[model samples]
Target chain A: MHVTPGQPLMVCEHCDAVYRRRILARREVAHCTRCGAILERHQWLSLDKQFALIVAAGIVFIIANVEPIVQVSLGSSNATTTLWGAAIAMWNDQSQVVAVLAALTLFFFPLTQILTFGWLLAFARRGERAPGFRQAMVMVHYVRPWSMIEVFMLGTLVAVVKASSYFKVVPGAGIWSFGVLTLLITVFASHDPRQLWHKTVGSNE
Target chain B: MTGVVTARERGLVGCHVCGLVSRAKHVPPGAMCPRCHAPLHRRKTNSLTRTWALLIAAALLYLPANLLPIMRTVSLGNVDDNTILSGVIELWRNDSWDLAIIVFVASIVVPMMKFLVLGTLLVSVQRKSRWALKQRARFYRLVELVGYWSMLDVFVVALLSALVHFQVLSRVEPKPGVIYFGLVVVLTMLASMSFDPRLIWDRKETDD
Candidate 1:
């Protein structure tokens, strides 16, 4: 495959058919000719747009970590827990592996995503490439599937349903924050990874 | 000679990163994709070995996950410890049939089905049995999609443990079973990733 400076060679991963990459007009998408899988979309958000989303996600993530997700009051006494608190409570109860996984999926990976993307996008916005940007992009791809905030939130909903049968489960600031954060993360992740890699790395390959 | 042509017949290998078909003959060994820098692999390295390892690990974890208590609730000097199956039965007894079904399918049915399906696919591939190739591929896709939902039970335990505390009067906490169960879910997902779906197509050229 002779990849000229502008015309890059593309292969369909689904069907293994090679084709010359073509430019697309705004709102146009390139699909694999053999398998009909989406190859690339033209109208991707700019780096600054992605940066704005990252900032919003970062704020919500902080709130979700700090505030209580739910508070339960039975008689005179009450109990509340933030996301980390839940993981720690599991740790104290001898379920150490689950606690560690909870922390990694819910807290660690998402924060790493935000920080890595924030740095890369900031560099791209300034028309400059940061050192290790390629590595960061790879990290983002690997981390995306492992970060299970949406799944965790759904689990929280199921927990709430289970708890609602026995006692009053008051929704707290953390739950709302987590909801918003999950949405933002989805929005952030939905963009085509190929396009982002192209913009950040810039036709260098 | 006018029969079905494979990608290898045309010297084409798909780029896993950019989804582009490139001529395999022209690319030297260990060359990166011209469009994207991802390293090219004809098939995932050590695909079968890795898949088997992960599958066995998941199977081992499955034992403790189902046998032990997932969560325990202590209320007003009374105690109840619920394993995955017992928890489903408790939900059914309480007349929350919908929740019971959901938990049953997500927790019980999904894992078992995944194990059976993946094991079958592995066997068929190893034996070079070209039966229902397309359906088998679709089944693999289903296994991938349904992988995360199995975590529902674990999340429920975490949520309840965090919320339900009555300072000496009542308490709820996750048990050791959940940790093992969580491991089972993750290990299976990793096993799926280690599998190469393209291997399913490779059989077509060799058989039938």
Candidate 2:
């Protein structure tokens, strides 16, 4: 029953024993089965690398938002719209679900998550463990579910094809950039969490 | 009293705090009870069942999404329906290389890869086979991470449907693919959710 840092603590609940730190990082399993017992708890992240990724992802995100994603043509009339423009177009047409979804998943959620993660990472890098680190981490977790920009992009492609019969839809530079941006963000986000956790914990200790 | 070794004496410990019971031998030096944050014993619960259920549901949904028509169109003079592939091809023909590639990768390649890779990992875990547990976990994580990208097609559809509302001149409507694509996303997400990466370590411990 004795607890101490640097010692692997196992929890037994319902006759099951599991390591404490693993459960904390994964945040799902929290009980042992055999004889229920409390387990170890640890949470940390790396500040420096996380900051770098945030900066890179932030710049790409800004570019993705500013550039036009697709160009549409009907007869001789041609027009293009950026990420935000697409959302506005949806809202203007009364497609509230689509508009809100587009805005939140593609633009809002990601923007917030990246910015928040970046801020936390920067602060942590300065050897300042803000009391709100846990709160910020929760925000990152919540935003993770909503950051579905890439998925929205796929749905957009399907929509374009269905609409092609009525109008000529052309892919724009923004679309391509956004596509790459989606891939980059996906990779960076996945890597950032694990790396940040390592860095933050290391620095704090 | 007669000489008797109780379960607890046999290394079976129960955490009164969280009601978790496990073999005392496996308990970590400082490990606490998972449920109540009390002390722990040796054995831990396996999370494979929950993860497997999730993965199976994902696999089930993945099938219909691919086979069904993603988009349905009703035009004034013509009726041209499109699937995910047809949509990508249209982009390619239109000289929208970037868009076409994006569509191909996000809607087609990435989702398909996720399904295959995740399915493989789940199957391997179920069989309790340890080929590349760490690598498999990493792959599962990648699939979970990238599962959202499949929404690219969906976003395009929503955007176009909203923007191209000129009425008689032209209009686009949601098709079955929107639903199917949504299902794909949901299924993959479920698959990711159901996967228990800890299963990988289970095999390692057993081997050790």
Candidate 3:
């Protein structure tokens, strides 16, 4: 780890261990010498690549929202529900808390995060700072934990399997869209998001 | 090891928001990071108190979350009510052991482990044991990673309730227990976030 002149210092978020920031080659990672939390990583995706993934996820998000998540058939009658319809049905069931929770986790937070990323990247791509960059970054951190898309996907699969024992169930286009959205979002997250703090204007480094 | 220095000893606080290392002592009241304009604090305020409160609330709710029925299935005049545990058994009895294990771990095992691990970390930090510091830090990370998976069961209940919506043939309805279970998961998640792992490294001595 060769530190450059006027090198910036970084303190581990997991531990308080401080170290001078160093230049790393592509695909290299810097681990905290203390508690072993990752300090930095050379992400595989460039800004354009990540931006593309974000856009693709945004499109898939729409499809996931609009299409039916699953279709159930019982004798002569059949039913299909989208994520929005499900949340509304949940609300109609009189459990406002669960309804809101379902709405926020499965729909609202992910949408907000995507919009925030779009706003942040619009400016960051040009070597500038996004308006409300601080709030945006904080939202990203907080919302990432609560979004729960992949978890929702797993839940759908489990629900399908459990429902299969009782009746005819079919996973729908929305489930496929959700699957794709999960991969795109995962890909974006795997590329360390903190790198944005370094790339934008007013960078400490 | 003897040569190691911390931001605290150097009177510097790295910006928790933007990673800018700046002097701590000289900053004016309500100082914000110059780069991102985030308010700077050496440590998160009321970390332990808040974590304990939330964890305890979650523990209290864990009872109803388990004891009462999470969801009920009504089909052809027959009703089957299942709690978190019984739901897993229902899945298993139906011969889906893989899903049974997944639900068992995520819904049941994960939250319990969080309570135990987080409770231990809080006690250890208060006592300042200075033992296995590295492992404690890793434990906190693990808690954060697995904390959200507890929501899996909640979603399963919601989707199941939403999909099987028919009067005569079959229908799924979330019971009051599902609400308590949802609260338990959310509370534990907040508890884990309220915890600040850096506290594990703080010492009372003049120097390490």
| Candidate number achieving the greatest DockQ relative to the actual structure | 3
Q: What is the DockQ for all candidates, taken in turn?
A: 0.40, 0.16, 0.51
Best by TM-score: 3
Please compute the TM-score of chain B alone for each predicted structure, in the order given: 0.91, 0.70, 0.93
lDDT for each residue of candidate 1 in A1-205, tens digit (9 for 90 to 100): 6433454666555434456668788788887553455666774667789889998998899999999988877777778888888888888888788889889988999899889888877888776666776667667767877888888787777777678778878989988998998899888876765555556545354
The list of candidate 3 runs beyond 4 A from truth reads A1-5, A202-205, B26-29, B205-208
Ranking, TM-score, top scorer first: 3, 1, 2
Better candidate by TM-score, 2 or 3: 3
Clashes of 2: 92
Residue B12 displacement (Å), model 1:
5.0
Q: In candidate 1, what are the lDDT values of residues B1-208, reduced to their tens digit?
A: 2233445656666666555455665445577766556776666777788999999999999999999999999988889999999988877887778888988998999999889988988888888776887677778878877887898898789878877877667889788899899999999989988887666657455321
Global lDDT of each model?
Answer: 0.78, 0.60, 0.84
- Poorly placed runs, candidate 1 (over 4 Å): A1-7, A19-46, A126-128, A200-204, B1-39, B92-98, B204-208
TM-score of each: 0.86, 0.60, 0.94
lDDT of 3 by residue, A1-205 (tens): 1222375898888777789888889879899888889888878887877877888889999999999999988887888888877677668776667888989998999999888888888787887878777778877866888888999999989999998997799889999999999998888888766678878765443
